[model samples]
Target: MKREEFLKRGLGSLGLFAVIPALTACLKDEVNASTNTTTSTVTSDPTTTPSSCSVTNSETEGPFPTKSPADYVIQNIVSDRKGTPLTVKIYIRNVNDSCAIIKDAIVDIWHCDAAGLYSEYGGTGMQSVNLTSVHFLRGRQSTDANGMAAWTSIYPGWYSGRAPHIHVHVYNSAGKSLLVTQIAFPEDVSKTVYAQGVYASHGQADTSNAKDNVFGDGVTNEMSTVTGNTTDGYVLTHTIFVKG
Candidate 1:
């Protein structure tokens, strides 16, 4: 079955409605940044637009709501391209030192389509893959009573120029962004894609954690997973902390 279809069925079978109320209570109210010194809004061309995916202190849209992407409903399990089922568990925390532990932060995640193309971006020609009016492979889940959250999703495909990774955005109750980051897989899996010549040289397909420009920021190996090769495929676990 397609990943999207699998998620929908899984969520329905799990009775996710029973958990929505508790999850919603954990989010925080929106707050403006205290240190902003400028108020200029400029629109850039689509092709030149910067990546909205970031973990730094940047302003973003809000009203903190629960938005689940199309194929997010598998149990605490996921299957890779080879159809092996893998169990996943993610621990989330408050990473920002400025804020207190985000008691009820919200994490929104998304990724490229199975063919390794992002819906909003223009490069990938497979337009039919758009799962929703907005996009597919994207959704939101709230932190638990302990500031941790987990989900089961397939190990994403490797797109040209980038390693197999998952994109995440963290937000406080007020709908302000706390961080934007991508969790990467281990080098062995990463090298598998690179060796296939899927990405062009200009894309820096061979860059490692020490060399990748974005990952050069203050991220740690502790934030990602590197093991769990089960009969179903690989299991990837990652954790993130949000500071209120």
Candidate 2:
């Protein structure tokens, strides 16, 4: 009887020893998976706000701003002023959140044409004198489901002084403005873009982003990331975060 009991006890001990390694491996795997999940989602969490919100830099409205009311929003701002087909896309985000896309935001964009002429402005380089009625390269669109507002436009021409830039204004649903900023381009890209098309006449911008009065202080947040070339056109994208 004693011999039989000892054999049964030895079998039980062997079983426990075998199960222990499997259990340990399973637990370790679960812990590793949990750690990886946390690491992957850290940047995407909306609750993790930055120490300081990266709000879009406020910039001057320039000399030729449209007096059009807020309700006069249009998706296509390019109008008659035409050149290489460039598209401007603005992604709106909440400053207090973790750059989470905010839908239904209003975005207004305006800029000069390849001739350094503003549609609504009348001056030395303008196509028309006192051209307040024109509305080229200017329009407004609401952010879509992905918090993006896009406009089909031409590559802007540079004049003697100012760097090529697009002026942007973002407003909330209640018509309260969240930000006013300018979108700058990379020096090499801007130079290459201006080398051809209608932009070639005036050549590259004499005033670079560093030298530009408005873009001097705050260009890091204002600069745009461009994809594509002058022949096929370019897509300019910038993200703007505003008051939460």
Candidate 3:
């Protein structure tokens, strides 16, 4: 999926809940831009957004679609797409129950490069090239037994009228789509990460989450708890709840 804005971390296991492992988030205290160092610990603090499956709001799929554009499934989708390192963690849970993880579901992710250009398509503004033969920050995968999927890509860049975000698609074993949505990041975190170069030339993001037409309603369960800095690479996590 693509957005009027742009796209789409990693996760670790914590505890047991309802016979399933409870999801926990670990965020770093600070990020050192120069050395890229950080400190982390598991936390269930109020600031963590997707700590449990509360059913994130379904979002609109933007213009560029990779379900048919992307060639296959890949775990590390950072082929020459430079920028701050970002690991995206996706947890799929059943909305009808106590957020049970849904195994065997296919998850697809796509977003702009550090320069804010999308692959497989040409555009104006920040992106001015056709990437039909190029595959940068695009990947697809199936959820593991824990109902979790992860991808290693750079932090997404901004476009117009939208905040910094990522797009996600979940498909059943039969390839039927179950969820279409996007994940958001905090404004402060975006500022800190972008300042380390890479996306600095893009200037400040033109839109805030509140001003963003897509996430303006408030990110709520769709926002991720970002830890680590651009130096140490960022680890992001979010839980997606879909109908069974």
Candidate 4:
């Protein structure tokens, strides 16, 4: 009887030893899965805000809307105006759907030169210098398949009663006005740009975004992402969503 009991006890011990390794492997696998989940969560977070697909805010076309925007449908709008070079890229998305790219949409952009002066409109109650015929810092382009229209221009300067901004007018393929908006610059970046070279002579903007007539309501949907410095120039990118 004692010998039989001993044999049974030994078998039980062997079974436990075999089962222990399997249990340990199961626990390790669970831990590995947890680690993978945490890694995925961290990687998914990005610094830039993902496009929200909401319609952009509509703004005034401003006093200096290009007289004949369709006439200047060229990519390089730099003309004779000089300042820190800026590359403007606008992405047009359809808010009526899922904010998908809207191809063949017309995008018109215009801004003041380094000295806080516009090309076409001046010499009046609004402006003092006469430049009625000169057309610079203004152009229009159709969006590509990716819904992007790009232009090579210069960093815009600020005038009194307004902050540094870019005016945009978007139209559908059939010439219907979709949205008119303005792009606001980051104050810190504008300060940095204004302190250098040609921008230095004119000084900084007199008005702040929070105090401006158009942006005072808010700039959450109109602000642009500007990268680079005064030396190498800058790139301005903004996404505009319209009903389409």
67-186 in candidate 1: lDDT tens per residue? Answer: 443233223322221222222344454434432234446566665533554534343354334433333344555566655555544445544444455677775544456776676556
Q: What are the per-residue Cα lDDT tens digits for candidate 2 across 1-244?
A: 2322322222223321111111111001111111111111112222333354578788888777655624235555555554666777878889767677777776778888777887766845534566677776776667888888887777677766788888888877555678878888777777776666656667778897788899877586777877666556677777777885
Whole-model lDDT values for every prediction: 0.41, 0.65, 0.69, 0.73
Q: Would you estimate the TM-scores of all the predictions?
A: 0.51, 0.74, 0.77, 0.79
TM-score winner between 2 and 3, please give it: 3
> Which runs of model 2 end up more than 4 angstroms from their true locations?
1-53, 69-72, 123-129
lDDT of 2: 0.65
The deviation in Å at residue 73 for candidate 4 is: 0.6
User: Which prediction has the highest lDDT against the true structure?
Assistant: 4
Which ranking of candidates, highest lDDT first? 4, 3, 2, 1
Query: Tens-digit lDDT track for model 3 on 64-167?
Result: 76745224357777776667788888878877766677877778888887666778777554456777677667777677877778887888888777788898
Clashes found in each candidate (C-alpha, N, C closer than 3 A): 21, 0, 11, 0
RMSD values for the candidates in order, in angstroms, are 15.9, 24.7, 10.5, 26.7
Clashing pairs in 4: none
Q: What is the lDDT of residue 103 in candidate 3?
A: 78
